[model samples]
Target: MADKVVPIKEQKLMDVKLGQLPSWLAARDYSAQGIFLGFKAGYDRFFNKYINVKNAGIGGFAMLMTGYVILSYTWSYSHLKTERIRKYH
Candidate 1:
């Protein structure tokens, strides 16, 4: 008699503990193509449509960081100039 091999069907559901959501979201699932595609599309749409705050959340953070860097550089240059003047006097 020949042995029969039972094949397992691939499932879309990802298994994990309750507190592992961020890790799970970072992980890639090659088995669930449909679910992953849907999730990506939904996430992109949500970010595009639901993000109504004009330059006040993620964009605001980016702008603030840039402004801070620029202002810091300007301040450093001014402080160095003052130091040079004091040294020359």
Candidate 2:
């Protein structure tokens, strides 16, 4: 008789530990963790693809600064528009 190898997906599903917790809670936690990790992995892939500069630290800092500038501009623009409308009223 020959042994067949089980797929990793089945192996992982079989390895869930339901210690001191209800079956539904354990499954829900496992599913939520999986989704969070999957989203982080996808975001990391996209960031690495676009932000591959010479220095990793500098690249990260640049991205942070860019995001800050964008948010600042949007905030100031919205505030100014609201102030203009208030003055007219």
> For each candidate, what TM-score against the reference?
0.25, 0.31
Model 2's TM-score against the true structure = 0.31
Per-residue lDDT over 1-89 for candidate 1, one digit per residue giving the tens place of the 0 to 100 score: 99554322322235444566555555545568868897897667656654645653676456557878999989799777877766553
Best candidate, lDDT: 2
lDDT of each: 0.61, 0.64
Residue-wise C-alpha lDDT for candidate 2, range 8-85, written one tens digit per residue? 343343454455234534444357878898679767875776566555566666876898999998979977787776
Q: Each candidate: how many clashes? A: 0, 0
C-alpha positional error of residue 60 in candidate 1 after TM-score superposition, expressed in Å: 0.8
lDDT of 1 at 49: 56
